[model samples]
Target: MRVAVTGSTGRLGSALVAALADAPFTGPRGPVAWTRADLDLDAPAGVVQALDRDRPEVVVHAAAWTDVDGCAREPELALRRNGEATGTLAAACAERGIDLLVVSTNEVFGGDREDHTGYAPSDPTAPPNAYGRSKLAGEQAATDAFERAGAMGSASLGIARTAWLFGPPGRDFPHKILDAAARALAEGQPLRAVDDEWGTPTYAADVADAIVELLAEDALAGVHHLVNGGIATRATWAEDVLGRLSIDAPVEPVPGTTWARASVPPRWGVLAATPLPSGEPMRSWQAAMADYA
Candidate 1:
């Protein structure tokens, strides 16, 4: 089971490498190979070439254009990375009869709903922002590739949609909040955060572990929400991080409108989780955060 992982330098990608390094299941017979530079989002042809060369049993697609506001500003770039690249990679894997596990996002559901409940895998998708639209396009492209490949060389595609991931090797929301708190404390100023936006804050390691589990499962196909179990607002998450850091800086809770950001923030709760057919829940966000601190 030689596995080829893209975006080896990203937050989740790095964690996936580390997880596979320590995983007992990934032995000599099932080695995990990582490619960061040679096969990147900009070079889809290179990605296809790498897949052909490696002929890996599984290809974990993690590279993407993740900047929400940037996606809104430059949709063409987003489409190139998130949409076109994904389609190309899926086609490549399909041609070689290699399984592909695509890492997706909860943003596919426009966070405009009033309710803050968890979104199931079957929920209707209505992406409000350009980033979500591009990710949704990637998902559709992967599915289409599998369909086009037919029964002969089609690969098994699993779209794992996650949310609010944070961890080492990259900047995430928790790290950002902690850094802002530290800066505020050093400057003797108050930290302000948006209290309205709500979602699950997942740890990258946990998401990586879930991906490994999903890969090992036999009947795990189609779309699945792989987020932590709990939900919290941005302000609450900020306060929690501050508390973990032993910083008492006053975290001012402000509405989302106060931020005045370029991109349209998802107002409705974006936190989501779903049990696999195996009846196992994803890792807990609290435990993942504890590891972060």
Candidate 2:
């Protein structure tokens, strides 16, 4: 099918675009991408214009103001992009009878429940920060828009709530850690990372695959957490990267207070794709890392 994707150059969007191009159902139009210049979220009205221009049957809404701390400082700007623009896009998609598949976040849940396994799909959302709140608002808006508009015959809505996204060659955690380890090793210095925060490390390519799978399923609806199958502290993940690189330097654990930010993210924001099809689970982060390496 004809597919239009937003945020074509973003960490996850690029992967989705590539995956869509390789997907079995992608049409001759291919996966049309609309960057910020093409569809400015600041101007919600432009969403309709861009959608009209692309005229795709499915729209993967991946663009968002992702600066978490920046969003906390400027909720209005964040909401305008993450919330209002999403509503506009959803409404436009509904009007055009196009399927809407959106990228949501694990931050929507109050990640304060550290002792728990993780947030499930059925859990009641309680966003702690503006970024999360805006994302939650967008999710609600998308659902309402689809249900109200009654997606033209077979058109539907699918929400992929992913977390701690990584997996780009020079942008993923492993790359950064490996780079730092290489540099530090050259200078004989110790590595340090935050230990307090914990979350799943989702590979962007894997998540993109999951998103394509989600879109293929016409019966799928509502939210689905599309993250890797494991969780770990920031420091531990760093250690794993270091070990894989065969770097002898030890990484010291630091607390969150060491880094000052306007927003306070959840301490344990692990995500679980509850009620998923039995015998289907995301591959482990370690396995994904191995593939990336």
Candidate 3:
């Protein structure tokens, strides 16, 4: 199948490209087109036009305005990328009878929820911050497009929500933490991290693999949570990452309130997938972190 992956330049998108490079459906004879350009989220109309011209069998929508704090500061840009862009892609896919897979976020759930363990697919969505709100809007827009295009066929939309993604060649939490640790060690400064915030850390490679599996499975439609199996606070995660990297930086535990951020981060928004026919759950965050380190 000819697949078009948006945001092919991002960490997760790049990983997906690597995974698909050797995929059975994308070998020397198989069909695959990996693009990091032309489908820019900033130009939704241009993206739709490109998709219409390419007429790919599947469209993986991965581009988005992911800066959480930046989203809070600039909601208009967030809505444009996360919300309007989704609708445009979904509509384009619906018109061509192509499968549209939208990569979403765990932040859609209000972080204020008391249950920090994790969120389920059925859980209610109440975004606590602007980022979450924008993502939720994107989800709704995709769903609405699917509903309006019911005449096309059965469920052409797939929402794969993940969290705390980290890997090589991308600006992610693990890289940032390790960079900070190295700087602190070099400057003889102490590294401080928030112990209050909690969530699952997903590896970009694992997530890319899961997306391929989901696309191949016929029964894997609708909303699904895709993340690493385990959960941990930022402090614990930082310490584990440092330990794995053989770094001896002392990470000080600090509360979320102590950070004094402008927006209230979700105390907990970890997620668990609702079981797939492949019977494979996401790898544990610890295991993923080890590989990432």
Candidate 4:
């Protein structure tokens, strides 16, 4: 299978590149890779042209404007990068008979968090922030394009949504918390983190592994949450990282509202795999973070 991957140097994208290297896949010229400089998704016409040049059998559309607060400040940039960029890629993939696997987010749902019931893939989506709304728009655009292509002939599309991802090669929540702990340890202060924000932290490597599996399995399509098995609060995750670091520092738990400078996430964003995959559940965030440093 020939595969082209966008965001090829991102935390998740780099992980995908590593995972695909071991698999029985190759690109037209070789391992197809596109960093931001290689494919500026904000100007989406370049993406279509690049894909047309690569002419791969499959494309993993992982690039997007993911800064939440940044999105709120510049909603147009968010929509153009996350929404228009995705539409261009989807439409091009459909026209060229290329399979597309778009990476989405858990923020796409803003339902009652008190329900505690993890979100199913079939649930209706209503994002609470510009970032989430733009991502949802991208998902809808990709789905519509794939459906239209299917109506015309054969085309595969999968939207793999994840949340609170952490690992090497990028700055994630766990890394932030780790940095906080180091500073606190040095200053002899307690770490302050929000206990109200609940979400399942995921390992980028694990999520990337699932994406490769999904792309290989043409039978599986549509939205799927490829997160760790369970959920935990931000404070809990921070405390766990501290514990893993063997740092006996005190932690001050606060509500997410106190930490919300621009946008506040729902109380719960835990995602469940609607239909179980062939492999075991992804390793817990803590387990993955133990090797993060």
Candidate 5:
């Protein structure tokens, strides 16, 4: 099957492109990478025109305004880019009968609960911040589009929600931790991290692989939590990365309140994975990090 991925150069997008190339199910056509220059979400006309030009069997919408703090500062722009743009894409895809899989976030769940377990796909959503709300809007928009097209249960629409995603080609959480370790070592201070904020640190390549498996198994519809096996607090995750790098810099555990940001993330952003095509648990973040390091 021919597949195209938006946000071709992004952390997860780039990984998806690579995974698609190696995936046997992609067939001889391989994968097409659509950058923003090719199809900007801000311009619905261009999106529709581009979709018509490319005409891939499947479109994986990976582009988004992922700057959480920036989204908080400009909620309207976030809604326009992350929410309304998604609706535009979903509508176009549904009209053309093209399968669409939207990459979403676990932040859609309000982490107000003081529980240790992860959120399932069927859990009630109550996003606490603008970024989460915007993403949730995108999810709803996709669902609405499919339903309007009389294809709600056709398995042609999908939402792949992931959490704490980290990988190469960008300054993700693990990269920041490594940078902080270097800075702390030079300044003679310990790296401070939030212990209360717990999440599963997912690897981008792994998520891409899972997404491919879902498509191959014809299980792309509905919500799927494609996260790592285990959960870790910010401090513990930082410690693991530092240890893997052989950096002896001490890490100080602190509450989430101590590390303030413009946007408020779900303290419990962990997402429980559903049964994968392989019928095995996703790899642990530790093992993925080992390969990354």
Candidate 6:
């Protein structure tokens, strides 16, 4: 199949690209890697033109305005870039009879829920912050486009929502915690983490693998949640990382409100994975972190 991946240079996107190359359905051309220069979301009108040119059988839309705090500060820009731009791409794909899978976030749910088991794919969405609101809008737009495109022969639309992605050697949470632990030990202070906030810490590689498997199975329609099997708060996740590294520096737990940020992340952003092709949930974050470490 002729597959195309957007945000190909990013952490998760890079993993997806690598997975596709190793996938059974990968064509001789492999996956088309598109950076912002190739398909800028800022210019929505050119989306269809690009789609026509690439003529990809499947387009995995991973590009987004990922700066949560920045999105909170400039909500309108967030909506334009993440929401409206996605709608344009979805409409374009629908018209061309191309299957599309949009990468989404756990933040789409209002995190204020008392339940901790994790949100299901069919749960009602109620975003608590600006970034979540924008992503939810994108999801709605994509669904709307699919509905409008009557009798889309082989076309399918999938939404894969993930949470607290951490992977790639020096760019994510584990590395950040290591750095913070080093600093805290040197300064004789404890590393502080938010205990009140809870979510799954998913490995990018795992999510990418799951996505490739999903595509191979032709299960690209409806909402899917791809996350690690278990859940953890920021503090517990940090402790796990530190324990794996044998770091002895103490990690202090604090409320989410202790550190003020422009955006509010979902407190309980955990998402239960939909039944995967193998009929098994993804491995636990601890196991994934071990490989990453």
- CA lDDT of each prediction against the hidden true structure: 0.79, 0.82, 0.80, 0.80, 0.89, 0.89
TM-score of each prediction: 0.93, 0.91, 0.93, 0.93, 0.97, 0.97
Encode model 4's per-residue lDDT on 188-240: one tens digit a residue.
Answer: 88898999778888888988778777766653466788887677899988888
Cα lDDT tens digits, model 3, 30-145, are 33444536666677777666766776788778888888888988888888889988888787777668888889998898877774557888888898888888888998888888
Number of clashing residue pairs in every model?
0, 1, 0, 0, 0, 0
Error of 2 at 63 (Å): 0.5
Give model 6 RMSD, 1 decimal: 1.2
How do the residues 1-76 of candidate 2 rate in per-residue lDDT, one tens digit apiece? 7888898889888999999888888865568887987668898777777777778888888899989998999998
Q: Which parts of model 3 are misplaced by more than 4 Å? A: 27-36, 151-155
- lDDT for each residue of candidate 6 in 1-293, tens digit (9 for 90 to 100): 98889889888889999999999798777898888876687997776766778889899999899899999999999999889989988888888889999999999999877866789998888999999999999998888887798625559999999999998734688888889999999999999999998898999999999999889999888899999988798999999999987889899999989978999898888887889978988999989988988
Clashing pairs in 2: 1-25
Q: Candidate 6: where is the Cα deviation over 4 Å?
A: 151-153
Candidate 6 residue 185 Cα shift, in angstroms, is: 1.4
Candidate 4 has its poorest 10 consecutive residues by lDDT at 22-31
lDDT of model 3, residue 88: 81
Q: Model 1: residues >4 Å from true position, as ranges?
A: 29-32, 151-154, 269-271
Candidate with more favorable, higher lDDT: 4 or 5:
5
What is every candidate's alpha-carbon RMSD to the true fold?
A: 2.0, 2.2, 1.9, 2.0, 1.2, 1.2
2 against 3, candidate with superior TM-score = 3
